[model samples]
Target: MEDVMSLEGPVLKVNGELVLIIPLSAGGDELMKCSRGISEVQGEFLKIVIPEWLAGMLGIEEGDLVCVHNTDGKFHISPSSPRRVH
Candidate 1:
């Protein structure tokens, strides 16, 4: 997984994997649950590629869904909006 760190501190330790953090934009202490398939798992790290438009943003308040898909024996990472909550 990719090393996720901020100047303040490292939120996650690098296990040779990558993780995406979507921070809520709303001015409240709220949390959203995202569910996506394991498209690719690399050395204890996962490569979750969302949509190009939602590539970089903050928060899960935008929606209540996330999708994870594997295509043709390959890990096709893409953005998904799930209907159910995990």
Candidate 2:
């Protein structure tokens, strides 16, 4: 199987709130499961979790390129990337 840079995860709810979880890895050695709102899984990549409502307002969808600016606490989502979950 071809290794992906990012993987899109299904939306789930915890405590009656919508959330989006994603599995991300850089060097393929470590796997991080990150989530928005409430997450049941503890993840190393906790920095990029985007909330569902904000994602919707920004038109962020599965496989979209989400760039997070940690310094200013802002993010930009682009629909140009065609990468998706396999």
Candidate 3:
């Protein structure tokens, strides 16, 4: 949507919560604020409450690669293990 056209920035975790501060490119060029609650944490996967609008734009589904980056550092996630499948 044009409302959230330019939403891209570093990701952060505060008080055991994940927050994404996206900047809005339209309507005043202000920052579009949004956050997702932590539903569960399993091993390397963190179940977060992703916004429907964002989900559609990102084309993310049940299982997908979600790279989390912050001032501390960055990390990448894959659906499958790095080891041999067979």
Cα lDDT tens digits, model 3, 1-86, are 23332222333454444333322232112221221232333343333455555545554444344443222222222223123337
lDDT of candidate 2 over 1-47, digit per residue (tens): 53333433443454554444443343212222222333334463333
Candidate 3 local lDDT, residue 61? 40
Summed backbone clashes in each candidate are 14, 0, 0
Question: How many Å off is the CA of 2 in candidate 3?
Answer: 32
Q: TM-score for candidate 3, please give it.
A: 0.29
- Could you tell which candidate, 1 or 3, scores higher by TM-score? 3
As for model 3, its CA RMSD to the true structure in angstroms is 12.9
Candidate 2 accuracy as lDDT: 0.40
Give the TM-score comparing model 2 with the true structure, all chains together. Answer: 0.33
In order of appearance, the predictions have TM-scores of 0.23, 0.33, 0.29
Candidate 1 RMSD to the real structure: 14.9
- Candidate 1 lDDT over residue span 1-86, tens digit each: 43222111112222433343323342001211222352243444333434434434422223334333222323322334423446
Better of 2 and 3 by TM-score: 2
